[model samples]
Target: MKNEPIYLDQEENELLNEIENGEWVSNPLSPQERQAYQNNAKYTKSLQEKRQTTIRFSVSDLAVIKAKSKEMGIGYQNLIQALVHNYAVGKIKLEA
Candidate 1:
C-alpha cells in the first residue's frame, strides 16, 4: 500500500525549523511521564522480538521479494518474516 505524503502547514514547518535551530529547550519529564515512557519502551521492545537465521533462495525469487520489500519501505528480511508468519497463521495461502 502506498502512503500519501504528509504536507506540513507553515506553523508546523516553523516549529521543525526552530527545533533544528536549537531554539527550543527541552525540559526533563515529570515522574508520571517517566513511568509512562518506561512502560511504552518495554511494550515496544516486546513487540520487536526477533531471531536471526540464514536461508537460501533462488536469485529470481530473491529479486522479487527484494523488489516488493523496497516498495513497502521495509527491509527484505522483515518482509520475508511477515510472509512466513502470515502463511503460518493462514492469513495467506499458496495456490500450488
Candidate 2:
C-alpha cells in the first residue's frame, strides 16, 4: 500500500521553502574536521555531567544567594553551578 504524504509543520515548511529558494548552503565537513567536532561534543557532554558534593555555606551567604537567585528567576543551586562553570572556563576570576 502507498503511504500518504507527510505534512510539514510551519517551521519545517518554512525551512523547506528556504532550501528550495537556495537560501541555505551546504558545506560538507572533512574527516579531520568531523572528528574534531565529535571530540568537542564529547568533551562538552563530559563537562555537562553533574556530580553531587557537600558544601558548607555561612547563613548570611546562603540567604544572599537565595535572594539573588530568586531575583534572577533561578534556583540557588543553578546560580552556584553557573558561577563555578564560569570560573572554571576563565569567564570569572578571583583576586589573590
Candidate 3:
C-alpha cells in the first residue's frame, strides 16, 4: 500500500502530527538495545494471547458483523472477540 497520507482516525492524524513535530526522532539503537526492544515487544504481544476456535454463522450475519467492524474501524475478528468477552463479563446483555 502506498504510504500516501489518507484522512482516517484520530490516531492516524496524531501519528502524522508526531512525525511532523519530530517526536518520532530517536538516537540510533545499539544492537543490544534493538534486541531488548524486540524481546519486550514479543513479550508484550504474548500477553494478548489468543486461541483458535471455529464457530458457524449464517452468511447474512457474518456480513453484518464484517460491516459493523469496518464501521467501527476494527477488524471483524477483534470486534467479535470483544463482543464475546463483553457479553461474558456481563457488560453486554440480551433483552427480549
Ranking by lDDT: 2, 1, 3
| Ten contiguous residues with the weakest lDDT in model 3 | 4-13
lDDT of 2 at 84: 88
lDDT of 3: 0.92
lDDT of 2 by residue, 1-96 (tens): 379888999999988998999897778999999999999999999987889999999999999999999999999999999998999999999999
Query: lDDT for each of the candidates?
Result: 0.93, 0.95, 0.92
Ranking by TM-score: 2, 3, 1
Best by lDDT: 2
TM-score of each: 0.47, 0.53, 0.48
Best prediction by TM-score: 2
Model 2 scores worst on lDDT over the 10 consecutive residues at 1-10
10-96, model 3: which lDDT tens digit per residue?
988887888999897657999999999999999999978988999999999999999999999999999999999999889999999
lDDT of 2 at 83: 97
Clashing pairs in 2: none
lDDT of 2: 0.95
lDDT of 1 by residue, 1-96 (tens): 279887899999988988999897778999999999999999999977987888999999999999999999999998999999999889999997
In model 2, state the lDDT of residue 23: 95
